[model samples]
Target chain A: MAGDKMLFVIVIGCGRLGANLASGMSAAGHSVVAVDSRQSAFDALDSRFSGYKIEGDATEFAVLQQAKTVSADLVVAVTDNDNVNLMAAQIAATVFKVPRVVARIEDPRKEDIYRALGIETICPATLAGRAFMASLESTPPKGAHNA
Target chain B: MNVLIVGGGKVVYFLCRAFISKGYSLTIVNRDSAECAWLARRLKAVIVHGDGTDLQILEECGAERCDAILAVTGHDQDNLAICQQARIRFNVQRTLAMVNDPDNEEVFRKLGVSAAFSTTRIITSLIEQRTGFEDIINLVPLEEGKVNLTEVVLRDISPVAGRALSDIALPENSLIAIVTRNGSPIIPRGGTVLAAGDRLVVITLPENMGRVIKLLTGGR
Candidate 1:
């Protein structure tokens, strides 16, 4: 949507969120590198996904180096493990000095910590809770019927 | 002195006891609630039930005012984050992290952690000293293992056994500090003659250690 400007992005983990982001970003004409500890996880990426795939633990600094995080414009750490995501995000922010770093944290309590460290985080539980609450508060469209 | 320790396990339990005995005020941050309860009851310290890598939890534990922070979590990444946060955000004077992978030690050091200890490297070195090479025993490692104090035992068939210390070609920067033969110790001099069964206390760079060992043990 922001013209044809291509951005270098590194996505840690190959879970649903990571795979989707990598594929979606690549489709949008961005250079993307997706990393996962298990090679099998890369199977989730669709054939249209044009990003590079790296099989290694993101927690290890060498793996991040292999991903070429130093030149990355954005880093997304979406690993299922909170500590792994946090560490990856911190390395991207503090060590590599990536312009933008985001981590998916499952624990809402960790939001303050991420904020303190200046890391952007998305928590699915909080988002889902808010969405459910909004659904309860909003009335359905006149044409819509209860299933 | 106030100390903040992150993680709970056998190591943390022992450290808690040691710090308590040393009269240091202690606070522990751990994610496991059960472990937190156990630590709270067993140790004379405050236990916070949350991840140590979390800034809120760390702040609640008074990380900013702590004299030292020890991040000894079983997970290397968690330990790294905890130590980094302690140093960068809290500005703790001293931060120590336990690295499960020895290769991560340098990375941690470069990231500004005051100290990084790898149990794997320590155990590997200990085992190597006990069973490796047969002639060279590493006494101590200095300068992050760049230099070492080594003990080389001279064998009967060693090429330098009967040679004067000055005559034997040694690796650069290597110096034989003392030679103990039979039951007496002698400070090595240029004219000192090396003998079989003599134990040579040498200081050398780690890269040249093998060469020194081979020279003293007849290349065995």
Candidate 2:
């Protein structure tokens, strides 16, 4: 879908979401640079992933500098820790002037504040919670009601 | 005054004691259950057991009414998040955060943290000041680095070493605060003579720090 423009992408946190996005974007011919504190997290990237990996804390400016975040058109922060995602995303948005930045915040309540700071936020908790609630309404799970 | 402190450790314990002495109300939040119990038993402040960065935990701590919030977590990101949440969500008047990385001090301040101090910055500044210009005894960046408290040691190489304070042309907005000679502090005056080994504590703007040092040390 992002094929219209060849963009440079920086994905912080090489976890499941980060790996998948980096792999897919790289496969789509976008230049992808993935960063993670743990070197092992790079293993999650798809075999076709041609992006570069930088093992470092995304919250640090030096690491982002090493990742050449200044040239990034899009930055995605999906670390397990919401705080890390918030800090890293803010740096990419404000400091590096990335065109688009997204952060994964598990807490739905924090989405507004994150957005107010000019960073786009995705709440996995709220998304899953809504889907699970909808399924419960349709299936009428008796065991869940009793438990 | 009411203060809410996020994250618990020796810093929290000492902070609580200091605030208690000043008769300020205190609330401390920490994630570890054992640390919370320990802090609760020792300090007079209320100890909250939960992630300090969690907005719910901060709200439960009555952050909305807290006069100040201090986030001294080991992680810089967590501290920044806690301070951001306190300022944005709770609208806390004053939010202070401990930055683990010295570089994050400016970044945190840019991101809306009221005050971001780094022990690493202080230590590194001390080392750097001591290393360079061996004549500079100590250097402290005050008022968020806008003002500098610089202590310079006068030597024979200084042009104004033996001159009276009034005779030397001190830069504008800069003053010699104190002069210490032979382990004795002397309030500087127009008649005060600069000795070769005298320690002069000069207060100056960061931009004028170099000029002040150059004027005193007779360096280019």
Best TM-score among the predictions, by candidate number: 2
Model 2 error, position A3 (Å) = 6.0
lDDT comparing candidate 2 with the true structure: 0.88
* Chain A TM-score from candidate 2: 0.88
- Native-contact recovery for every candidate? 0.40, 0.63
How far is each candidate from the true structure, as Cα RMSD in Å?
6.6, 4.2
lDDT of 1 by residue, B48-153 (tens): 9997887788989999999999999889988977887788778898988998877677667766677788898879778876674656676766765568898788
Off by over 4 Å in 2: A1-4, A129-147, B124-133
| Cα misplacement distance, residue A25 of candidate 1 (Å) | 4.1
Tens digits of per-residue lDDT, candidate 1, A1-147, equal: 357889999999899999999999998889999999999999998876898999999988889999999999999999999888988897789888998999998988777768877899999999999999999879777668854
Runs with alpha carbons beyond 4 Å of true place in candidate 1: A1-9, A28-31, A65-75, A80-82, A89-147, B134-220
Which residue pairs overlap in candidate 2's backbone? none
Q: State the weakest 10-residue window (summed lDDT) of model 1 chain A.
A: A138-147
Angstrom error of the Cα, residue B1, model 1: value is: 3.0
